[model samples]
Target chain A: MIYVKELCKTFRVARRDGGMKNTLKSFFHREYTEIHALDHLNFTIGEGEMVGYIGPNGAGKSSTVKVLSGILVPDSGICTVGGRVPWKERTAHVAQIGVVFGQRSQLWWDVPVIDTFTLLRDIYSVPETIYRRNLDELTEMLGLSQLLRTPTRQLSLGQRMRCEIAASLIHDPKILFLDEPTIGLDAVSKIAVRDFIKARNRERGTTVILTTHDMQDIEALTERILLIGRGRILRDGSLDALKREYMTERHMTVLCAGLDADTLSLPAGMTLSESHPDRAVFSLDTTVLPVSDAIAAVSAQTDIYDLSVENPSLDTLITHLYKEYEVG
Target chain B: MKQFKKVPAHRLYGTFFSMHLRAAMEYKSSFLMSFFGMTLTSLASFFAIWLLFDRFHTVDGYTLSEVLLCYSVILMGFSVSEIFLRGFDTFAGQVQSGSFDRLLLRPRSLLFSVLVSRMEFARTGRFLQGILVTAYAVTHADIVWTPARAGAYLLMLLGCCVFFSSLLILQAGVCFFTIEGLEVMNIFSHGGKELGSYPLDIYGSRPLILFFTFLVPLACAQYYPFLYLTGRADCGLYALTPLWTLAFLLVCIGVWRIGVRKYQSTGS
Candidate 1:
């Protein structure tokens, strides 16, 4: 339920050389350099579709979220979230969206988390019955029942984050924009958050657009992925398709009786990546040679005691993608 | 789509007010210290004025009680505005910290949200002190209290609050462009309060009076209304001069709207 076309936002930043004289001169006559935070960015997200927005730092991810949430006005673009121009019809538009900036806490610092939720309830004008239902459901799902009465400052980071998420959802927004929601959470907390998000998407059909650096989050939660870099969308496809394209090379680790890497002659696509007296690791290009053929080829050299094959992890694949795209 | 009723503005404001109160109550000792500290600070300023009045029985042809009346009106107006309009007063911090973005994400008037986001209840110290001083001035100033005079007095208090509150809003609007609060803005908000403690005509300069009357409109809230209240100005229209502050408020809100539209939120 989101449409964006030719979205452009440029920021003018002051530039100066580092010196007292230069600082003084620049103070009098400053120069400005314009950075395009969003450059003709275009994307369309359908209702109830969970899409992962992946990008490196300063890649317009947060800028895109801000524009969608009505926090920033783009220089030139047409963006309508659920048929409302975000900046033009901000109040009406924002009412249908929930945003969580992981780095910022929306809950009041010294008060119980429930206080902020009630404040949000009033702020969004959520009906009493709906508010009660949402609050009860969120409290149960996020395991916030025990934490709601604690002051926000007294809670641990993970507890605070759960409360933050609940606060954003108090109005039952149709669209959810979560920017780095899993950042800094422990593994258990991350899993909890991801599970809740998945269940929410499944049960309520909430349109979820998440931007995160954690590749596992993308792998676990989203079906569709939008890879952004340098203020532009570089890739848009399903996660499985992206994995298939990048997962051509499989790592084969074989524990054998005798393996002499220097004396071994390998197939054209297979290279011995690591070697020991009884263990050898091979990087096999499965596109050129199948896993079974590589296993047969290695078995001929030595008696195999143990063997394991692994596709590259999402983190490595993403790094490879970033390098290929020349983006950070 | 589920139909949602709009929450009244007063209810939203009450929620914010109670939230802030609860948050403040968490640090009870700190709140008490600051509350009393604020009262003592304003009381010291009033004591200084009392000393000055004792030394010079009549400065600028105005009696001690008349000066006290002017001072208390400005004091009450400024403190009351400071108590409620603290959100605008400290808006630069919100903009810098990205909390203003959170406000925009809500379905409410931006101005009203900013107005209620913060309430410096500690300033009630200054407010109560102002009330006491006004009680003293009202008894001693010897003004014949006609209904019109009473109405003008109430209007003066309201105009003073609006006048300072508008200045705070104007300063907040400037924060959108600068990203930091300018200390120079204090000259108008704080300095105007100090200068307005006495009637504008007592400044004894036509240019200064004209500046306050036309530019800042502080004289409209304070001087002209006081003149009508004290029977010094026979024109009934002087009582209506406080209405000029309303126009100033409108202008300030216009500037704020422009600032919001021009706002490029800080980087996340």
Candidate 2:
């Protein structure tokens, strides 16, 4: 549904010293430094794919989203979504895509949330029947019935987020670009939003590209991730594949009915670190021994009450990805 | 898709405006007080001119009634422009506050969204005051109003409105590039009204041409058309000089388009 090739965006930034002399000099002649916000970025997302757009701060995540949604024109690139060049055919392209910038609101502050939706309905020229169907489904799924009557300024952050999601989808857009959609929400609201997104992907086949720092959101919603750094795509694969490849360590905790002992046998690359009377912890290097092999070896020697093994977290995986790429 | 159905853009604007009005009404005491306060300020502007005429009986041989004719049109046009186009005037704040991004993402034209999303209802009181002043001017000015003359006067009013609105649009378009929209834009918005309230001819040849051609097209919308209205100009087509106001509007829009293209490159 989306194809980006060698997409480059560069910004001309003014450069000046901090003190007074340079500030006055800047008024007469500005020295500009060119920063390439995006450099030869390449990615393609298929229709109905729920892709996680992962990156650190200033990693061009928002810039990529802006380009795809037809908000910004890249300096040089070929980006086509659904057979249309986004920036060139902005109105037509934007009609098929929905964007939610979690940092910003698209709703009118003083009006009831529903009124803003009504305005959006006219804006996209959504048919009456289609609008009602979408509104009904969203109101039910997102628990937006209560929010519709409240003016947006009066709504809580979570409530406003739910309404923003509804407002974005009023036209039944084919693709949804969510930029940190669950930011600042309580756990309940976060799960509610996550579940609603999953349901929308499943039921409506809406292709979702979600950019977020919250790893749990990635874990819960996306299987495929586009790991980006320094305006470049470092890895594009299934989340499981990433965890298996770069997830070098596994943590295991053992709870025993008896006293913790030093007699436990560990494989060559694994070591036991902490021990209490009835519990022990092991840090196993997955590169040297697979998690299953470590588990098998540990189970054989222990009179264990219970043992739990944990994979490297998505956060660690991402951190390593950034380090591995040395994205700057 | 749906045969390009007539979008309810205007009706939506009405709904948005009324909602904004309701919010304004929540501070009912302030809303009412500001409504009167605006009219009083516009009255002060007229009194400034009236007092000037008191000292000098006539300006460059133009009588008080003739001056009022020029003065009333300036007041009405400026008030109308400020009432409807205040968003553009204050768009630098919108850019700083990140609300301009909201306009960008909406499926409407950016210009229309900014124009329709907000209005100053308090300034509409200034418009009413301008009309009252114009009524006083129209009755006192001893001029024979032929049907064509009346039409020219109406056209001049509309042309002035268009001229000033175009200036605001140009100012907003430039804001998208600079991030800090120039405050110098206010000089044209306010100064045009102050200067256009008198005869442009009194301001010397260069000032007359500058006002006729650029900055605000005040001469096209007021001076030349008023001359024809007052029988000071013999050519009937002089009455049609108000149409030049439209060319000024077009040029402003063209400049705005260039600024918008620069904005696309900068993405601010």
Candidate 3:
């Protein structure tokens, strides 16, 4: 279990002008600005639960993950993971958790991937039997049999990401913190990673806290989504709940061959978003105007060649959510 | 299932060294060139010393063999410490590249992880030169062989390693505050190496001798221990002066812990 209350963190950033003269002057008399990276953030995560943490750039997602993983101590707050204060008992806290930073590799670049795994086994002090068992399981599950003997430098991005995930799980940590695990990965590798994560959670009851800008990773893996922006938790609920609350409308695009610009009119509660000579896109409130009625109106006014309706994509919904919370 | 026992620190260090060696071997030609380059550089210094001795039979009342003995001990100590502590030497790069975060996530001592992250076996080039100088100095220097004297020499070697390693730890610790690292620290690490290669009294500066003795403990590892070895000092206290290097080490470790705390709070 993880619990955090009123978590607050701030950073001091040095400021200087562009010119050499200003740079030299600031070196003598420096100026600094305080950035509030975390502001009274609060959350509770039960065991065996998968939560997707989403935010824009500079939204404190990484900061929150760092604090939770015992890498960074918060300025003011109470954060406890499995009944131990993370920063106060870092070794003990980190022993039960595994973290993977997609942008940074923990493996030695020139060494074979298996060499890193064995070294990590020793570092984590895994039992001989448990080590072998976990290694076999991770290798088989992640399809790492072929890549283990190869050096990390030689592996493709997707192959390397698979190995990275397997490496983090060598100790069989109870809580996994994944920061952008699917970044720069191909479609097949992305699904492989997601499926592996799901299996791990199901089999081991591992609580996972993942942060990513990729909404699909969140939609595919997490039922619960925590949206944070500008150092605050803007929304916290199930992904479905957020969608239901914020995205009641649907989008429809129509292709009409002989539509008169002056006579073309959308049905009630429909707004024309884009219009061209042969294509028109309309945003319709499904609660007010059904797709069938809107299509009938357009077809009656002109000869409709084609029409398609789709629920607002998660990207659009998230953009609307960000606007609602006044977060960029 | 069998119980899990933490790998002993020594064993872990051995594993780290082996891993480093394996990585170094990947580029066999580059490794050989680096090893040869370091050997040639140190050989040039030894030749300079030999030229000086050819002109003067002794330097500051210490015979040529005695000065070579002092220089070799300092060289071995610095090179051995540099071999194992290369990670700390390049700690600023680790901080900038964010590998330091990965180290923090591991469940081991930060110092231990940092010490083992990189090992420069090329430093063995200097080690070989130092060993050769020590062998020549031992054969030519007129010192009575005694078990007690051998023990003191071993202590001196250990002290030298600690002294140099403490300097590296201090350098790494400073990175927490100033991420770019202070080049001025070279004045101590490299400067200590250059100064320690000669007798402290040769400079004829009392304040310099005092600073090395009490502050950095260079005299403790080199001069005082040498005096006992050369029979110039009969006091066992002088022989044991090298142990004082531990006090300097402890101070460095204390500073490192404070720096770690600062890093944790700042989260850089």
Q: Per-residue lDDT of A45-115 in model 1, one digit per residue for the tens?
A: 99999999998898989899999998888889899999998988888988999999999888999998889
Candidate 2: tens digits of C-alpha lDDT, residues B1-268: 3433536778767766776786676667888899999888878978888999999989888989998888888888888888888888787788778777667666677777788767888777889988987899888887898898888888778878887887788788778677888888878877888888887887778855675656567788888888888889978787787788788778877877677667666776
Report the TM-score of candidate 2, chain B only: 0.91
Q: Judged by lDDT, which candidate is best?
A: 1
Evaluate residue A297 in candidate 1 and report its C-alpha lDDT on the 0 to 100 scale. 90
RMSD of each: 1.4, 2.6, 1.8
Candidate 1 vs candidate 3: the TM-score winner is 1
- Candidate order by lDDT, decreasing, is 1, 3, 2
Q: Candidate 2 chain B: minimum summed lDDT over ten consecutive residues — where?
A: B1-10
Off by over 4 Å in 2: A255-266, A275-280, A290-307, B1-9, B204-211
lDDT digits (tens) for residues B61-145 of candidate 1: 8888998889988998899889999999999999888888888888999999899889998779999998998999988997999
lDDT of each: 0.90, 0.84, 0.89
Rank by DockQ (best first): 3, 1, 2
TM-scores for every predicted model: 0.98, 0.93, 0.97
